[model samples]
Target: MSTLIVPKLDEQPWPTLGPQIAAFIEERAIFGPGSLKGQPARLDADKKAALYRLYEVYPQGHPLQGRRRFKRGSISWRKGLAKTEFMAWVAFAELHPEGPVRCDGFDAHGRPVGRPVNDPYIPMLAVTAEQVEELAYGALSVMCAEGPDAEFFDVSLERIIRLDEYGRADGKAVPLSNNPGARDGARTTFQCFDEPHRLYLPRAKSAHETMVANLEKRVLEDPWGLYVGTAGELGQESIAEGIHEEALAIDRGEIDDPQLFHFHREAGGTYDMSQREQVIEAVREATGPVGEYGPGQFESIAKQWERPSADKAMLERLWLNRWVRSGQQAFDPNAWANNGLPGSIPDGALVTAGFDGARYRDSTAIVITEVSSGRQELWALWERPADVDEWELPLDELRESMAYLFEVMDVWRLYCDPFFLEETVAAWQGRWPKKVYEWRTNVASTVVHAVRAYREAIASGEVHWSQGDPQAADLARHIGAAGRRRTNFVDDDGQPMFMLQKIHPDRKFDAAMAGLLSWEARRDAISSGVTRSRSSKMLVF
Candidate 1:
């Protein structure tokens, strides 16, 4: 099966304490809330191999000899692969009094030996309160309560506190709540974020960031993070996808590696979705031995995929562990992730611009794309504050940003939606009469045609985002929230035309619209032999 094992193995592998740690886990850990609710927990061969990789350390007497080589370890397996349960055991090793979770000294054969951390403070965090009872925390609860090592701790639904000779609390494992107060967990020795894809809520994301920063405080413990989950929906600006991108950057050598090891597995073999047997084989390949024992896991997934109402895209993403976005998302998350090049366009470089305007409830954006390199940058964006009803679109700032773009870059064309700003557009047109045009997004034919061209440009590597800009994350959110919206028009080949739409009514994709307009402007400029402008840079407004 095709797998993504980052930082490809060295000619000689590093020594690890994984075997002893694994033995401890199997002896003390019990199954979490699942089909094997109270059964002894076991790791399949594939998962055990991944565990060895996670624990691989530097050699015996180096400066950081016993410290873990990978401070952050991730396993991206298919659904039904027991990823949550597998990670829960790692948490157990961290929290248990007898667990050999930390490395102390090297063995006679040069293998790292392990020991328990003193006064461990481990938190198994779930994105929401409801998920705490179903995910990693839940599994941990079961293992501590029902396992052979029940005598080692005082287990309760609230928390698991390890006991010493006098029954005093030595270390503890708790399910952190998703509240503002619960996020200040600075005493953490090891933190686990369960199904971080669901961790997109503002408070949840904040909690994660806060917890990550806390990992530095307990340096002596050699603190680490363990993340395990199935593939998540590609967009939604998920925490999972963010880490995935970081691993990719490390793989590309664009950034210094922070000892992150990502084990990403997908069904490897080619298959026809139409063939039922082939579909089952792909599912089996992805799930490995985990699917073998699950109650009808492989057959059930295949049936779901064959259902008339099923989301084939989502099924492919979840069951096959592919990164392609599901739910008719307008842009490919992989494509967008791969296309962000690190640089900025020089001032006076020719570029095309697009504008999408909105009033109080929504957002406004102006995206610019360089004529020569096809790099798009989020020049400006404005959003209304949720608590403030007395807000405006800040047209003055919008106009100023546009003027800056014009003065800095030789804008060849400016395509703008005049909605809620017809007078402003008129004034700008009057100033740069030859360079600006009033492009109405309400026109189905023109808008759809332009949107298709923009999508094609993005997919074909003809357009990309600049990584140097901190505002790229904001633009990524706007782009990620966009799904498909069917238009009344069709393409020249007779396929139905589509425009970007919000996956939810409350979500904002205005930057995507602005990007589409900018790309459309670029398309027109490229066709008319007007890719660049040598005119003197000036903006009257």
Candidate 2:
């Protein structure tokens, strides 16, 4: 929460339509202008106008059907496909609609609260003319279909309001570091992460972190965090991949009670390569082979969008959004989604804690996994000094939290970042230290531990979550795409010391980092691990 600072409401401009679109949106969705008392359809004037314009402007061959998934390669037909524009517009409708939709709320401490505010609205975040309109319409349609009872709240205040040019409220982007009265006039709701794939890089990732953190803080716990985007790039890394992984999990049911919405052109069918030669030979005899085309051509055409042009394997893993396995990793989301949360932990088990620290203005997280019961609980409980205050606090507070966790919760051990608060930690140890064991992680060590812990938890059937908790689910998603650094550091004896490097340039799972530290600490703390049932209830302070 600290390193990932949420900009104030005034930081960005409100999502306002042009004069014509604005008029249309107001007329269709909200109440009609002037003497007109009532209107047809399920919408008010603003809803109607916005939805009408959106439906009217969608381009031919574009994917508009809210079926299982839209066909890909449709963008290729248009000269200048404006997906971003459409998405932006969709985001606007979701946030600014006259009625309500499902949304989350948060307290000043950033803890989630209340039943989700489910309103009948869909928001998009498009960036082009046609896209803006089409996306707007698609979102509105979804809203209308949901009817009056369906409503959701949002955490994104800025996206809800109208913005001027320069990505600012009044044409000037406010400096997040210096602006006051930022969130004065913004709206809030169940947050949507539109087009996550577009932000694959570090800068994009950071922006996403900022946005998501802001929303999380605002929406509180159990709010729906919807992510809509195509798969881009592969590798076990990237935020898009994370979304894809979660969708896969929801599809498979590894996470319980997950409401998954995904659409892909290539998911409906499959092809057999073994019959290719014979089919190709027949095709060759028929059409003279069309140069090098054969039975494989059919398969390729069918799967064109299933993978990307760069890094076929990676693309398959990422864009195709399929599970990419290298070894005997357990808990395939596809498989688990079908099975439900693994009965890994026995009921009434002993649990340990894992904590990850953050640098800059990031969150501090604590993850508890019941060793016997297999129940897993993760909380990004604490925020950084910068998140709440202008400057950073040196060390006293962190040490106090750490000590409290160690003593009160029977937290066997702690996994933590050495660099984030290295000096502060030193100060803590110097002033009033416990003989507590610790694992200081670097990027490389963090990755190893991450893979080990995740694989072990899933493979061992020891990881379970609270059903129907999007907050925990979102944390899981964030953990999925977290990558690690290449090299790590060592101590005086050349022993692996800490995970100092970053996973992605922009994105780092501070929560995951804390989890890693906790995992490592558990190993160091216990002699013979206690039975899972013996672990006490989750401790929260």
Candidate 3:
């Protein structure tokens, strides 16, 4: 059997607390399923390293010693890696009275001894009742079934009860579903968020956001949480992906937040799925220690790969732990990343603005493109806040920003999509006359041409964006989330023209739409012989 070790970040040496937690897990917990079912839970090297890093703390005599360095930690590994089993072990340890205590100092053996927290409350959260039952409750129940730990902690179908000397429940592990009311007021010491990718749907997103916000309150308490799941789809906008992106930003020094820790292991992007050897290597790398934990794993993978109905994207996601985007992605993320320049659009440059608006749920975006160099700028985006239920875009603020842009730059044309903004468009058109034009996006043939032209421009590197601009990154995200769909209209040669559609309902594509409209306006201006010299001064309409 081949052994594959995935590379990870280098950090500080593990404190004695790491090995202590690992010891607790090994001594108390048992495997829930697979080839190792009913056996002692031994920590593999990778799992031990992860636990050590997660539990690492500042050395004694430091002001922040014993306090957790990371408030939240994520494990983004491939499927069939016993992620649930590991999480269940951590959950059991945290629920135990002696787990996650303050370290006084190192002993003669350099081991860190811990002081316990009084009455710790741990919640195992998932998006569905069945998931909560299977992943959290099922694993915990199986681990605590027949041992001395079983007598110490009574395992039930609904919850895990840590009993006192008199047999009364002292501490507990609560299994929570998606209901926000059930999760409202309980103070949680530790939380396990399982399969957060399922929470990306619009209806479930609100609950997930609320739950996370509530967990943030733990900063005043124990302030530790764990997120364990497989890699989510690229454009899914999942909470798991959001956490991973934030961790990446922190890792790159783009942002500063010491409370977040992220760990992800997957195959390289260049690995081709078509080659059998490459596929097997990637799968082995992703499914670390499967030979020991899960016998017949490679045989199962080979069988699945040979099956006629196997989905390549699904295999990439589940086995290789890669983020497989839709086949119809409008722009390759690599191309977009390569096209970013270092500066914003030049001040007072001749520019055309494209406006795409939504009333309540969807986002509104304004994209500006410099006519001389085809550099696109994400001017503004108005999105609803995660916490607010009845939020609406501030039209007055939008109008003020628009007015400022027109006052500062030499505006050549303003193309508005006029969706839920007909009156606003009319007012702007009345003010600027020739400068403001309503662009009909509902027209199939026009949109087809615009999308095709914009896609070609991106592929050809005609579009440039400011590097390190957060708004520009948001624009790229929206563009990446757009996928092509066949339109009713066809071209002259009877070839079907494609229009952009959102990969998921909650994901916004307004920026991509605005870019397309802005590109169309740029093309029109160029074709009409409208030069930058003609628009050297601010608009006087």
Candidate 4:
């Protein structure tokens, strides 16, 4: 009989560090800290059951360990697993000494491989949910091991999953919910926040507070470290942006490093319109070999996911280390330059005032208007500088101007279209005795009315401006360029109310504010209020 030859276990070829990390395992996958040998595993039946209820699967990993790890061992692969199964595996992996590895995703063909490989693979271990479970498992895993010193506790946000949940985790989350308002149960040694830039303006405060709390709690154990998200809005208070700036300062030798890990999206240059074409061309060149659609295709592949335009811009900044502008105009400045009117009003014409209040660096201007020969004439303008107190402006000048118009022109009532300006209106009333005043509470609604009035007046040939007053013409152009559209807003009843929302936050013409004020001051006539005793002494006037 021929002797059966079995290769010695020690006779196996030892792969180099690169290939060993990149080695394909047909069934069991080894990741991170490498081979799982004698790592203590604590199978918690209660925590396992709770996770089972959440994910709907058995809590314990099958055969515990060393029954060669399965090909689907990494966090991402298990995430793609049945939810309950994935949860059970994450719970088990968290408590197990080796911190989660994957067997799927081929080195070249994208085929399933059992052993971990290291060919520029995406780090799936840092997935938000997986990180949370990993955090929860850390202490337990350490406890189950011989002593605390044997296991390292990673409190990084990359390992904490609970922050992503909305509301307290009473296991009420619907499957696949992406709620940001959820409570975090991940308590570990230290924590690192991920993607803070994705947070909305409204949620910024609460999210920041949570990070601070976690940092404080962990600091008691050691000089605990907290790493916030690294890419986001340009605001001073933006969490990601703030952290990234700090990291950049460290890199530039402007600051000392506390040994913090910074994964920054470098914005190499200013994001101006001038650089837009260059960016596009760069993307094209980078993807030229693939085809016209190659740029987008390459980016999608690089990101390993489909992303929205806003997110795409952010990702490009982060990973490719590219610079990109936010790329939308607040208002079109050209619209003002092309459409503005060009001088002083003719004598003995009807007049009105356009006044706007100042709040910031933007100055407020008041324009005097008159109607003459089928045209509106701008006679004069009074402007408030940004540096001075708006309330301290010369009221006597305004009064004198109105009084002069009343004497020389067919002056209309000086309209004060807003009732909310009680102080300003009262002041004006004190200055111009017997002058007319009009007011409305809802400025937005009144704006709608004024827009309609302007449309009608223009159609009827009742609107005109001075031929030489470029500022007045520019103001007109700004007003004319203001577009209108319905937008969804929440009413008092918590129901959706469709109203006219401004298209441009930066570029809106305060036409409504101006028109309402003008209309209130300059309307033609008013009928008296109804009264039964019309001939009484008080009513006879």
Report the number of the highest-lDDT candidate: 1
- Least accurate 10 contiguous residues by lDDT in model 3: 1-10
- 1-541 in candidate 4: lDDT tens per residue? 0111111112422111112222211112221111322333322332232222211111123332111111111110001112222232333232222322223223353222332211110111122454433432332232323232222222232232221123221111011112234433323232223334444354554544553444334322221222222234333244544444444444545444223333222323322323445444433332222234223643343433233344655555443333232322122323323333444565555556555533332223344444223344333344333224443445566457656665665544455543334566677778666554644424555544454455445545455555576556445534433444433444455643221223333323444345434533433322222121122212211
- The C-alpha TM-scores of every prediction are 0.67, 0.40, 0.70, 0.31
Put down candidate 3 lDDT per residue, 2-37, tens digits, no spaces.
221222344756464777788888887788855778
> What is the lDDT for 187 in model 4?
38
Tens-place lDDT digits, model 1, residues 369-462: 8877888888999976433566679878878888888778788889888888888889899989888898887777677777777777777877
- Steric collisions counted per model: 0, 119, 0, 33
Full candidate order by lDDT, most accurate first: 1, 3, 2, 4
- Candidate 4 CA-lDDT value: 0.34
TM-score quality measure for candidate 2: 0.40
Instruction: Choose the strongest candidate by TM-score.
Output: 3
Writing each residue's lDDT as its tens digit, candidate 2 over 1-541 gives 0010011112432222123334333333321112322232222232233223222211223352111111111110000122322333333343443322211233454322222123322233333223323443334333333323123322232222223233333111111211113432323233344445444556545544544444434332222334444444435355556655454544544555333333322221232323544333322222221223233553453353334453433433332233343322222333222222533433333457665665445566667655434455554354443214444533455567666554455443344455666765565456434533345553454555555555455545454564534456544544543443333655456744333233333333565555445454445434454432234443232
lDDT of 1 at 204: 79
In terms of TM-score, which candidate is stronger, 1 or 2?
A: 1
| Candidate 4 runs further than 4 Å off | 1-198, 206-338, 343-350, 355-411, 418-435, 441-447, 455-512, 519-541
